[model samples]
Target: MSIRSGLFKLLGLCLLAGVLVAGIMFPVVGAAGVISNQASETVESMSSSLADEPPPLVTTLTDREGKPFATLYEQYRIPTTSDQISEAMKWAIISVEDRRFYDHHGVDWKGTLRAAISNSSGGDMQGASTLTQQYVKNYLINVTYRGDELGQQKAQEASLARKLKEARIAIQLETKMTKEEILTGYLNVVEFSRQIYGVGAAAQAYFGTTAAELNVPQSALLAAMVNNPAVLDPWNNPEKAKERRNFVLDKMVENRKLAKEDAEKFKEEPLGVLPGGPDKPASTCVSADPAFGFFCQYVEDHLVEDLGMDKDDLYTGGYVIRTTMDRKATLEAKKAAEEEVRKDEPNVANTLSVIKPGKDSHEVVALVANKDYGTDSAAGQTVYGLPYEVFNVTGAGSSFKIFTAAAAMEQKKYGIFDTVPVPNFHVSPVFNWGGEHCPTRPSGVRTYCVSNASDGADTSMSLQDALAKSPNTTFVILEEETGMGPVVEMASKLGLRKTMASRPADGRQPDPDHEKPEYSMSQKEFYGPNELAPNGRGMFTLGASPVSGLELANVAATIMSGGVWCSPTPVLEVNDRAGKPFPVKEPECEQVVPEELANTLAVGLSKDTQPGGTAASAAAAAGWDRPMIGKTGTTQFQGSAAFVGATPQLAAAAMVFRPDIPYGGLSYGGPGNVHATANGNMFGGMTPAQTWFRAMKPIMADLPPEPLPQPDPAYTKMR
Candidate 1:
């Protein structure tokens, strides 16, 4: 060939290389006077603007003691700095993927020229991407183009434009970051397997080790997966995986990262991975440890509903959530609940909630249920939010009588020690009942009438005595005289806000024509003539509406805190992705009722564990001898029952109900929802009171015995 023809051919090859480099290599081609001015301008016009945000990282959830219990994430990645990574991992990856990683700025120019010439001759596409270029591509795909499928595809496409863009941005990145920084970022953002990213997660998932502890063989096996993770997966294709791993070991030997003898010895060793990979943490709240699952779920709900945080941020924003969940308290509560009512019991649920009382704010420590928190129904696991949610739960029964009592004292019309008539049966002159649940009179008008739980308690007694015995007729008449509106409002101010504001979810929209059409059930009951009861029945004191255990526990907290009301906060602190304090909307605490009235009421409630109280039997069975306030309640039709009580330190509530059949009543000594009981019937003083005593005995073992607040003479005086 002629010398001129040889130089022309070489020049043609160099110009073809400009296509991949966006004409950044035009200076070398321009020496032969073969580059166009338009191409030179195109190279100068290409921009490099890479995002500087860190990749998605795993969010951790810690308990009351700041110990990690769960992890939430969109991608299972734990970002590690260069110093935290082992030297074997760094050298092995460099040896197999990019041999001249430290020598090159961002792109391997010599390799690019050779690949361009080979491709121009119709050869297959060859890879010339340096570590920095690979880092740029991964950063765009995982962080910048996140959730944008088209943008992610465009970033990874094997086109000349994509390569040119990556090369330009990588060169700019090299200017800003050191070679070690580039390598660290690349290892942190690269996808080692489906849904698994970064060397930290990869080491744990594959070999049950950390990034800093990876040895030579494990490092070689991981480095081999960078080229094709799907094909070289050690779990599915072990032979191919071993072959690729040995190839990486050979490269490590050639690059002097490992001695030849050590490389060969590594080839003889087994894969040495855990049998089925490491045991990953519960990725979601439903899969958390049964002892802490419900509390974890409550934290999630509080973040989203109460604090106005985005639901997606829990998994993607890398927050460090520190919650007020006491592990010992929660486990004790769960054990007590399950011990009282077995988890596998048919159609029954037992839930317990614990709250720490404070004058300013209340802190929730435990929320537990007899059923395990999971998706498996056959194994007695449930994913329903039974502890926190009020939906589909049966009525709170006479546990609501505390609200009526509080309302009477707040009005200064009745004192706790005042005399009230308790009849065997009394008919209401104010309200006429509806068809099914009550009796119809001969005049075609059904007057509301109720009887006491025991015929012996028909005589007149103090309001404090009525509360301890929980007679139906006395509280029913009390509701009539105190006015249902004030009673219902008092429940809202105390803690039953969500329960009182709930409406049936039967596709019922608000009435467009009525004033304040979006009123809740409690509002309708107070205003009179609601959907269920015409002229607004007097069932408010009897706990006619569904209620939340969490709210009931907070009610006890309110009384124990001397009438102060506070939002039941689960989170103590939350740090954002950048480790800064994330501000949440704080609801101010207020004294909902007078401190004197609350303290007087607390004294009135303190007699429940004494001689003639409803919960006396349960308390005695547990060897109880504490100064505490207690109340037990059973729904009129045996649908549900509850026990709420408080000490100077902690307050709690426990309930027994039919979760599957929300409105179904419990049957005893026959074929019914709840089967095989200690007694022929189930009541608030039965399972619920027992559960509370069993749970609180151990929990209060270490707490010092403290007396409740003193009653004020103004409210304690009989009317």
Candidate 2:
């Protein structure tokens, strides 16, 4: 109990006091640091949400008469608002993931509070981070949640400092931008599925259209993506996606975002994924012919370049392109072709490809044998949508006439009536059917003998009569008269290119980087100097090269109608950002061929269908019952049958299908499958002609009938 004892005790008390004060200050400073870090990171993360990357423009296509056949869209990119965002899609994200998006800034204080309470309640997991904060961690902040099974959730939870940062950003965003902007930013950043990030992209991935174009069902389906993008991708997950979709609909109904009628309609609608995965690659078109699809894609590619516009701007930028198409003539040609398809013979397949003179736009109406569109193995397997954005077909057979005749006429080798004298015995350096020789016949005598290839002999006929009958001997002589070089040049002028995508020959392995290179050696063959495509050769006229049905139709259209090949037009007018539509400039048509020559050739070809002509059967189907104009050619691969004609107020062509029935194989098609139509007797005159008739009936009904033009008397034949 001395003074020393007292001093030591006091010193101990003082040391204890200092330790307690330091502990209090340490916690306060750490809390302050947490708050400051949170505030700074908040705005940076939200910035990534609304950033816009220029999307590829959609390439819209039109028919021969400048009507939209299909809408080629990229991003299905519709500039949408929160209101425009389907209630279904929005709910899918909110209910399953973050429910307080509307109530909070980028940071969810209430959610965090609830999560803290849940932790106190002894829950295994906790969630309070807002969608904006999550988006920031996933995108702008470099995706930190990618560790354990629940690593993302835990990592996201651990980012309160990150949450605080996003929260600060959300407040700034709300003040600097708008609710709509915030929503758009959120939508653009939200990952819905494989490689799909924005709502606009999601719309196309699910519905094959834009966000604005999505129906309730499609929207609901798309909304489900936010729940578990990879898991509930709708296309990959049916039941889960449906359940998720239904959940959204129920929420919307509960929230009154959609009427009961609309909700019910959506519930009843089917959910089907596009055959080609979500975002359609550029140049993809659903066509009756993949070959034809390639052509459509090619034209679209050139269109963007020729028009000098960004694809995104060209299609969605809302610009209108005008074309040079004669709807009247296009309909007529389409009708004539389908009339032949109606017969539906096993050997004879039918289709009509048409284009206006000088117009890049074209009309392609094909009469497919089946509606499946998936495979050709089935007996009645036909293609579904002619106007779909992705389709391809191998143009075969009688279609060769377009190039053959074009070559002959363009090179001035033969006039419409020039008597080229169908040879009875046409043996030449060219490889004929079965590698025999050209001019099937040895004698050069003149007679309208359709196809003497079987007899290895031929008769002679005038050029007009030969073309009308599609006689092999007649054309063989013409090929001789017109060298391959000039013939190829004329074919190009007619818009025919020789490279194709598959099946070798015309269908070779297509280069993914370049669209026009179907054939490996194409660039060396024809096209311009160092271009990808084959020039015409003596053997090239017999459908050896690849041309689309639509291209063929365009070629015939140029000739049948007074040669007006103007640029194709899909939209009638371009609209400004304000929704005001302005008419686009109309294109001009060119005189690709002499009107008199087109008329004369058309006149003479009519006779081929009259009797024993190659396409005579096709002609008979159009109510002619006997005489008409057409051309038919059979390949080792497939049969070629077509009938191109010009009636009063209508000028068109049609071809039919010969599904599975091979030539030079077991079924030769002589006894039955002559025209590849529905029935054995189906020919160009049958099914295609009948389909043509049916289509023409309605189109021509509204217009006054125009007289058929007379052929030029001075024109000579190629007999």
Q: Which segments of candidate 1 are over 4 A away from where they belong?
A: 1-16, 23-51, 110-126, 435-445, 504-535, 576-580, 662-681
Clash number for every model? Answer: 0, 128
Cα lDDT of model 1 overall? Answer: 0.79
Report the C-alpha displacement of residue 348, candidate 2, in angstroms.
8.6
TM-score per model over all chains: 0.88, 0.58
Predicted candidate 1 versus true structure: per-residue lDDT over 87-112, tens digit per residue: 99999999988899999988888877
- Model 2 TM-score is 0.58
The window of 10 residues in a row where model 2 has the poorest summed lDDT is 385-394
**Candidate 2 C-alpha RMSD relative to the actual structure:** 11.2
